[model samples]
Target chain A: MGDNLISVNNVSVNFDYQENFISKKQKIHAVNNINIKIKKGSFFGLVGESGSGKTTLGRAILGANKISSGNVIFHDDERDYELTNMNKQDLKEYRKKAQLIFQDPYAALSPRMTVRDIIAEPLEVMKITNSRQETDERVRDIAAKCRLNIEHLRRFPHAFSGGQRQRISIARALVSNPKFIVADESVAALDVSIQADILNLLKQLQTELNLTYLFISHDLSVVAHVCDVVAVMYLGHIVEMGPSRELFKNPKHSYTKALLSSIPSIDPEKRSEAIELKGEIPSALNPPPGCVFRTRCPNPGVDCKGGEITMGLTEVEPGHWVDQCCVL
Target chain B: MSHLLEVKNLDVKFDTDEGRITAVENISLTVDQGEVLGIVGESGSGKSVTAKSIMKLNPGNTSYNEDAEIILDNENVLQFTSKQDLKKIRGGKVSMIFQEPMASFAPAIKIGAQMVEQLLIHKNINKDEAKSISINMLKRVGIADAEKRFNQYAFELSGGMRQRAMIAMALSTMPKLLLADEPTTALDVTIQAQVINLIKDIIKEYQMGVIFITHDLGVIAQVADHVAVMYLGSVVEKGPVNEILKNPKHPYTKGLLQALPDINNLDAPLSPIPGNIPSPLDRPTGCVFRTRCPHHNPEGKDGKIEMKLIEVESGHWVDQCGIQCGQNG
Candidate 1:
């Protein structure tokens, strides 16, 4: 944990939703009891389908989402802060150390604002720099690092293409010099060629800035290339966690195996294996007891549904952790 | 055997507020019965525009060139006159599925009612026959509990189920050709695999020609028999799926293939094409891809370079002059 920049300890986020007009409320477990440690300068990936709560967990780390229980601790050489109980002033200061890169470049940036203003906004709101000149200089520095031309900064976002706009978004995220950044599906909206461009830029920046990333995405192939360690989440619980290569090559959990098999191979000769999961993701409001994934698991036994089974991490290999119950 | 659909020298332009912008240019491809032709391109590359041109589904501002010809079953669809003539060919002979399954359906209507309505309009059948056909089509597309799913609205179904319903509706008419525009793009990977398999199985069973448009090369590799790689409204490379994927001739095609992160080779570094795609309004002269093409040389002895499509092998074509220009002094 010494090298871990951010450590999440048993975090869970629950939301209350009205069942009907009848005054009945139900709890939606968006992010169940989870623990993850993002190492310094490492690209950690959190992957799942639409309702898997990856986004919520990412937001919780940034102090944007409410944490119903558990703690999220941010460690740095200068200072350490527990985000779950931070006051408003401390949270504001914590914001300068953490930021988010949004998913849709089209909707994320303001159409009327120029690229320079968009990037400078974080510095201005955070009061990191005093004078406008200081903010302008910082913006230019980060903009060049992100490969945005100085002349293009004066132009509005509409003038830039999807890839260029994403670069601007990256510049905006980096303006405050954040240590931990959550890039939530940042390249999901871009084309494949452009997606590579953004992905390479992110990897380069991670090393250059000595930054840590909690990259949340649903695309497995993209995650396989950019991330060092990967965690697969289902509903809200992480069923498998290991190095990217090891997990992708030999997945221990059945859910991880199904996900790896679902990726359409580029080689036309190789057809996907017959391991398709049946039915859609279950509703988080009424998730199945015991194992959250047991309803869709190909092999299920009486023990799988005995009671509310909490998964204890079992070290399958060095630095690899999987749900203990997953092993038949 | 005659091709089910043939598009020759097609060019589409739109009268925009700024000026006339060409959406698609000189694109040509053919889809034989039971064959799937993939049109792969990035956004604004005019892949969807080309698909829409088959059914003339573009807006009123769209203008097609005089020489453009879309021959469907030996009849030129561009020459379609009267609403009835277009109607008979549009949804009856050729049906389309869009990227957003939820938006494609009406919120107020039930899934079964919508399918039945489409059937009644296309086929001169009674209400009872239409209902039965609707239920059967839903079940054929792998929608479990078709009877129950039929009564539910589009909102009630999940993303995967909605896409299945959309497919079932599109195939209910028994069309000769199917135009699928990113039908599985909105689905999760697991669901996308399921939908892709369903589409392939249906194409085999019905023997219907398909024009599958997507930006995902992996999906194209799994489904398309022939691949047409488009860039900035032009087909940069066209060949059989194996030839295009394995032995790509064009520089743009090579860049695109290399850009994708291969699952088998996770450690390989991705080489994205440098520079952004030139906007439609600011399209470069000569080759449309020369602005960002790795094999583009602006300092030619004569002047700017000129590119032409050259047949590299049987049923394979690439831009020849672009490569020569980059290498020549």
Candidate 2:
């Protein structure tokens, strides 16, 4: 069927320190050798705790971060575009096909701008519309699709609640008719009830617009339900990758198991049995040499403690990959 | 047994530029020594306001109802109007850890200096003793290299470490009560678990009453002995944590439970409350949640049920409006 829309091949994003007199020459490898293919219309989830480089990877996919190495290929019906080496002209065309929905609704939308202007900024900036009338028409169409009342178009961001503000951001992201959407912790700031509403809206929009979502979040439960496939990141490395059901039902990596168990369950009794990871996430600047999770991994393999090992994925089962250092 | 802190008819209203907004309405809850009373609610549900009222921490333009009373150790806390008395009440007898640690700490001050200052306020200890105790408190909260960290500022520490330092400062006084207002909400899940576990252990060790305010039921189930589910200022339902999770009665509580994404049961559909939380200015007449209540009854006078929390089961409470109008068992 060959319907893979975006394939990330050995994508490594490194942030090099400025070589000033006082500064030492060091590099922060934000994303290290990541490879994953997002299907045409599937909800692909990239989940990890903070500082796990999940956000960096998501931004790398969007061409926001300067890639140190590797290439990202975007497949359309007509041609294959190398996202990493895209020229200005290509990037402009690529911008229409890919969009990003930010996490903080309060910070993302400008208080000075009206809801309509916020949604129309992308169209005007990208020169996707010929006239102001065309931009207004497209903004109104997307706002209605996002369930925003027509009267809300005139109001500023401060007048709307978190959920409504998020709806506005979603409408803004979708105004350009992007096929690939990267919603990076879009509902993390929302209340539980409101989070569900936003999530439902996202799902509905995905189907109606025929969109492929790269949902990045630290909350595993939310991703487990919303995504078809899940990739668990740990310190710039993907420790586990599999179908959502299979990953939750049978996690292969030690880090994945610890993460899965650490989620506070609604059932009060489940708290006691949680496998508590001993310490906080290690500094991303200097992660453990052999296994990135060795410092906090509940169960470490023989070579995991201090020895250097190749950071590679092993197909533990069909369509299920685990980090090579996993004790199993 | 006497409660460490008791809030009765606690109604808080803020006189804003637009209009007077009712923050908390006719609220009542008690926290016994060594007990954790969780107040769970969304942004505008007034859980933070209730927590703030305990320490008289609400800012200017805020007014407590005339009949409102908070009893601490058999003494009324509201009467302590003088700075002399409020100074002792603020951190000496009751300490609070906030959601954002960086905001609470003075950027100019060192972590050790802040903790030692708090310790000195509550206890008549020498500077050296206070510093040692501050270091010990930092160590107790699981911060590595406590001695080094003690000299550092809030900005120097990582998020989890900063939160730990905040907890260290809060506990340095050995206060009779602790008010943790969404202390772990901003942290990652793993760090959140660690903090929750730390709180659980400290709760056992200190036996001091704690008022844990958060919006997540999952966190409440972990750290709380009893939970009060607030909907737009009023506690719609409350009870023992087990009873609240296993057999929630109020439609709002049920809706919240349904909204939670069950990691184990990922297949189940999420039924979030139908409508957005009504703005405080346009809040419903009597049960504030009636606008979004799935089991709303039109029979109540002007579509408002008498606001009352009734004990439907042992240690479990459901708002009278919910019970009377609820169509489901």
| Best model number under DockQ | 1
Residue B176 local lDDT, model 2: 93
Best by lDDT: 1
**In angstroms, how far off is B137's CA in candidate 1?**
1.0
Candidate 2 ranges beyond 4 A from true positions? A18-21
Predicted candidate 2, C-alpha RMSD: 1.5
Report the lDDT tens digits of candidate 2 across residue range A5-76. Answer: 999999998887655968787888788899999999999999998988999998988899888899999998
Put down candidate 1 lDDT per residue, A1-328, tens digits, no spaces. Answer: 6899999999999999996789788899999889998898889999999999999999999989999999999998778899877898989989989999999999999998989899999999888999999999999999999999899999999988899999999999999999989999999999988999999999999889999999999999999999999999999999999999999988998888888888888998887674788888999999887788888887766788663566667889987888877865
User: For candidate 1, what is the TM-score?
Assistant: 0.97
Tens digits of lDDT, candidate 1, B1-329: 77889999899999999998988888888999999999998899999999998898999999999998999999999999789889988889999999999999999999999999889888999999998998999999999899999999999999999999999999999999999999999999989988998999999999999999999999998999999999888888898999999988677788888999998998789989888887788777677776676653654223354545678789887766545642432
